[model samples]
Target: MYNSNYYIPDLVEIQRQGFFNLLEKGIVEEISKRNPITCFEKQIEIFFYPEYYRLTKPFYSIQQAIFYKKSYVSKLYVPVQITDRKTKRVFLKWMLLAHFPLMTNRGHFLLNGSARVIINQLVRSPGIYFRENMHEIYSNKWSEKPSTSFRRFYADIICLKGTWLRIECDKDFSMWAKMKKGPKIPLLWFLLGMGLSEKYILNSVHKPMNLLESFTKEIEKNQRAKTFKELKYPYVSTSKKAWEQIQKLFKLKKTLRKSSSKNTFETKKSSIVSSSFTFFIQKRTEEKYNKNNETKSKKRIKNVQKGDPKQNSEKKIGSQLEAHELGRKWFSNKFMNPRTYDLGKQGRWSINKKLGLTIPIEQTTLTALDVLMATDSLMKIEDGFLEIDDIDHLKNKRVRTAGEALQEILSVGLIRLEKSIRLKLNGNTKQTFIQKNSFFNFHALISTRPMNGAFREFFGTHPLSQFMDQINPLAEITHKRRLSSLGPGGVSRDTATLAIRGIHPSHYGRICPIETPEGKNTGLVNSITTYAKISVQGFLESPFHKVYKGQVQKTLGVFFLAPDKEEHFQTATPDLRLTSLGFLPKNPIPVRIGKRFVRMRSHKLALMGVSPLQMISVATSFIPFLEHDDANRALMGSNMQRQAVPLIRPERPFIGTGLEARVVSDSGHAVLSKTSGYVIYSSGSKIYLYTF
Candidate 1:
């Protein structure tokens, strides 16, 4: 059965490339078209009165700021420039210490009234990987012997830009298979059975002629054989060699067993005798004397004590012999149970069981032989021992690509196949499914769903306004913007803690050393340096030069160039000229030498080669002072400080308190005073200024 859980869809179709592009593009367009000051005002207004919440008709209150012991006019009125009809003039406007929207050094925005900051997530590079797994085959009820052990090997080719393909095969050499979201089949026969030319198969490999010839020979041999059993048998020479190897392995195993058994027997016998003496020392000494006397009496009665003593001694000797025999039998039974004794007889089989051996000894040896035969067949095919015309079944199958061959193998293994679909905004469209029997549609499914709900909610929407409503409810909008470190396949909370538990060299240039949370997430979740950039290619470029002066030399350097310029080998000179082929070495050169490189000692460089770009100059890319501040802490400060209220005293003290307070009129107007002793105090009914 096809496992949907393991099935991963194409990354290209599912990634929110467009969404990220639109966000950045919209901000740039807004900046270019609108006046900075006017835009700031409009943003502030909208932030305080978000359209989504305003539409719900909720009650609103005017927020105010107070100035203590100062005239309202002096503190509130500030000079501002006003542009009217292309003429600029100075004007006095009522200005308070009201919070305004501020754009952070990072590409995030703060809502003036809400005191929230929005942070964009970091995107990671994608790549392909080969995953290894083991499969178990259970025994059939009818067969008394164990089930045939099978090892399944597979590779997952995840093309970040294209579709994903899974290629698999069993160790049995029966067939090779491929899968995307379905079962497997015999790759070779499936391709040939689909009527694809041998040329196609040859092209799939680095050396086509060898594969074709070997494949042809196997087919020809199978055709000559009358039964499956005959086809399964190896050549006389190969079988003889394999048999000899097996016999040698068996003999070696036997010798090792005999040596081990002798050692164990000696140790166990000594231990048993020593243990018996501890429990029956007195009885054992008496039995020995009795045995000697009995032997002496058998030859001469006079040797034994005369009279009743002689009879009693004889009876005691007989009882002692019986007791000794019983003890010996009891000790033997206790120490050597039937199961334990049988284990020694089982020998290698018992060892194999402990080692979790899946394949039988003989079958394992035969499998190795089969592998050699398969290799030999490929060699013969490469050497041109067989021709395409010799195989009659080639006319029936038409497998085209390596992927198709894999799919065919899976089909033969009785795996089910299904069609995958792609969901489009316009409508739901059906992706064409490849027929197992046909060779035309061999490519795997090419679409995948969004990895998670957060991805969909964040990237799927258009305008920022629309996203704000979903994240912050209209009924109870929060002033705080939630920033999450988690993203698609990103370092989770647990993983983040693990990364910070121990220091690593790779973290030196990538993670911020000073900037981390002081809370539960301390050191675990951290910010990357401003200059740090993740490579789309999934590999970091190290800064090193192959040639310097007259001799080939390596130097630590990081080159910062435009992506396009870097691709064309253009140096970041005044004119931005491309370097000549002769002057440029075959290997990549560093873009720029960072401060870290300058500080590095010559011995350090010689000992441990230069570090990769990701390992240097991390602080350059982030905000100067804010980079070290914890994100959670910053958020808490922003929200908490906004709600802070100043403390005021009702009575003035004899010593000057050096504290000033502002009184506001009941009509929401600031009452400013020049008197130093004037203090603004608030009561239940009215705000009052008391002079002491």
Candidate 2:
């Protein structure tokens, strides 16, 4: 009837709910969408077995172990079944053994019989984050007020695979792409490369269709008379031409450095500088001269006001092209690889080289095109286009889903997917196989050894597995517990505790107040109350009073006995009758109801907001005598008693069992003997004693 290895009933429900939560999140749907033939059903079963232990010896047989070497081993295991949605067929049946990290009942695992708890962690959710900052530029003319510039916030798409694509815009409102050390490509071009539509990309970032239409109209109006063909189809232009267009779009005038003024003048006279370069230099020189004169005049005025002309004359003069002056340019040249320029210094370029890797853009495009063709999103293939090999394969094999194609690409290392398995596997093995790595597998802690036969028989096979057992019953049972702590990528204990203790408003009805452990883990380790339930939709719902005709009717209150009077009263209240008194305050005070008196604060009846009937149900459902003991003390008793050892001592025959009498004379002789009962009286020099 009682089995320690079997999962606790409440824990089983929680674990089942956790799996349903994943299903509700559409993870299975996503996987199925990617691999149409490989679908997953909603039905799942989990089985927990007892801890496994093994003793190995160098000798082949147990009889020969007298002089051979020996060792001990132990572990845990869980069995799982995954079924396909479309075919009503089982997809995978796995017996997860120890060495595989699975969630336990307490949100931890047992390793070598020692309990291990997981910690929660914080991770960036898959979404977009916007960032904006001020870009400050030095004043060109000190007297001319330095123009204030505002750089609009750009959108950064954090792909599900952890790739970051930054969308940068210039004064022309034309967007450019900047990945981690990747060149700046036109935004539209990059989207096309990813096999995504321009409209889809715009909608992903919340861009308005009206704004796009207006921008299109403006571009058409400005480029109507342009003879350049590339101007008409900028999105499809070559990278080099796109870069050149980006340059012309900004139209930043080249400036002559203050240090290069003499060189520029000589070059202008010798006709060494091109017309464009000459114009740029002259424009820069004029701007510099104006700035210097304005700064000097300001200094003179300030000096006159302070009566400190000598200090003004000593002001430091530095070259405009000094190392510090060109710091921004140098930094951008070395680190910022817009358009994939300066490949040698590009971070991704070097990384790719080191890994001997390259993205087969052509191959990716072909694959995308094939998928679109299969789905009829693109032009239909000609009737004779199908080759003999293609026709034969098409007849025998299921079409590869988009997910399958992507997975194949991933396997070839075309793109790196983010590591989702946070927990380490047994033997420190990094899980690379997606099939072996699952949402459930990542949380399961397994052991190899089978549980005791008696324990297995007592708990019996899981209901879902009973039919399978009828054909071939499992020889050994696997034990498992769903862990509560953070999985592989969880936060630390202190952080998790701090978060839980903060008591967010969302936890009001979802978490149980009475079922939390006492002391350090009080609120951190809590159990769901009986009335609380988690729905398949992933929301935790508890009972709430319903209003009839827009009015809440008065509810009767139950009487509860004080802790000291609990022994005298079998039930909290006599005959379980409702009292006229309503909810009472938290302060402890004596109250009379019917023919009994009790403390209102010390009992379940005093719980705020709960109806008397609900309170009675809660009290009855909880462990007996739990209300009488401190929560911390109860928790300590439950866990500590398991590790306690009983001691037995032998009694000594000489030890006294009952009352004894001893008499001593002035001469120093003493006698002791057992007495039934005695009385003594003193008369003159003689003492009288009687024994019965």
Candidate 3:
């Protein structure tokens, strides 16, 4: 490695890899699995099982697409096999799945002859994120005094595609849960619904006996007490009292169930019209009765209702229990079932990596152990044993490239296609299907419209999908490397807070601090640094050289470190002068480790940066004498560079930074000579060279 020198990495490799990944690993592997669509009742199964797919050499080339105003796309053919189990008959054929869009060499999709690029989105990663908020509540006392305030901690379990589960501690120190933004329910009740015994929960939260008592008292106050004024804080309750209350609640629930069972079930044929007509007749009959006798009849009706309080109470309790059971079932189906609440492979990996859990990555849905651990972490935060997360930090956010976005759209379209296949299978009976063997038209039954429509919807309406910026070669490449935080499943620009828009320490080398926009989207939209690359987990990383015991190891090469990993190592700046032998300066050097800026011995240094400009983007690095200019002016300078127009007689800058040559080479502006040659013939626009 060259000492104190930096080599430019592939700038547009991210975009290139993303598009190619979709074509290879994403679309073919995920969508071509065996038995993609199945209909058990009709004894039919449709397999996507890829026969072959073509990514390169599309049906319509880029030139043709531009001339004909068509999309440059490749055809996807899958071997579809339809099996009738009853008759043991099988129909096999190769069917067209879709006309998948193909990307150009410059990483752009040619849609309707216009080049488009999907801006990479910076989204909060899927995992349990903890937060604490303070709220003030009026005192129960009548005296005029300052209200008391309490800090409430919350843990949110975010999934890739399902309901969100938020657990928060109330002002009373009782834990409650809200699923899918539903009304708050006692954590104990939620656990109970999940089939956890009451005793187990009591044992779990009782480590801090006060939490258990508060939880039990809250349950009793909500269920038994009629007046809120009677409730008091700092509740002191024994285990016996808690057990007694729980038993009473169960008994009451049982009585309600028995009473509900006594009632007759409503017929499925009951219509809203019939119910309205009956109500109208009842009202008419009531009008015909004398006004004086109306009160007496109503009183008689009340007395008759009061005659069996148990019956009336049972009816009310039964409805409440039914609603409670319905909520339980809904949560189970939407949050617990693996089929409905898929977190995807990446989501599962993220959760496991974040929590350091040993659970298999294949278990994508939320589990009881995950809930318990998340809750425990909240308590740890309260006790100062754990750190609350900064949601805006790069560690908590990741890049969603075009590959992921396309895969999501494709998955949705495949689902729609599956539904259509199931409908067709259900419609045809075995007798009719056997009689009309010609009806087995795989092409007719399966339409590529769903996939095509999906692509159209994404390209037409998505905020991230934009017409390519072709003002200059720099602009075109910059457009592909752009990252935004506003889109579907991303933070709304209107509601984004200042904390989220401000620069953070983690962005030092990953995102360019000076290359953002100027107005509302100033920080929401940004560009990656020159040497920065995206990790497998989508985290941004910057290259650094390893320093071992006051010496820079040339053979070690450059190591890419994400923000989270970099925080653990002490890094020295490249400004420090090194000896001829590549040894560190013989003094306590000022180094940055984590958030602390301290002077440490050279032997303690872990990493040495390559250059000061490594933290800046290409546009910002191209400025001559950038250090002398103010940050605000430098930011404007960088912004204006992308808008620079090409000149008729192009000339290099008179006063320039050494980066001009590299930038020009990377921008695809100059065609470099590959071998020793001499120009034999030259024209006004072309140069012909003769080489040995």
Candidate whose TM-score is highest:
3
What TM value does model 2 have?
A: 0.29
Stretches off by above 4 angstroms in model 1 are 1-106, 110-124, 131-154, 159-163, 169-181, 184-198, 206-456, 459-485, 489-508, 513-524, 534-692
Backbone clashes under 3 angstroms, per model: 40, 40, 0
lDDT order, best first, reads 3, 2, 1
Q: In angstroms, give how far residue 318 of model 3 lies from its true place.
A: 11
lDDT of each: 0.29, 0.31, 0.71
Off by over 4 Å in 2: 1-12, 16-189, 196-241, 250-487, 491-501, 512-531, 537-545, 551-692
The TM-score of candidate 3 is 0.82
Cα RMSD, each candidate: 32.4, 26.8, 10.0
- Between 1 and 2, whose TM-score is larger? 2
Cα TM-score of candidate 1: 0.27
lDDT of 1: 0.29
Model 3: per-residue Cα lDDT over 134-183, one tens digit each: 87766666647548778878998888888888988876676767886534
Write one digit per residue (lDDT tens) for candidate 1, span 266-381. Answer: 44433332322222322333445557888753433333223345544543433433544544553334222331112211222322332234434322111122222333333333
lDDT for model 3, please: 0.71
> Regarding lDDT, does 1 or 3 come out ahead?
3
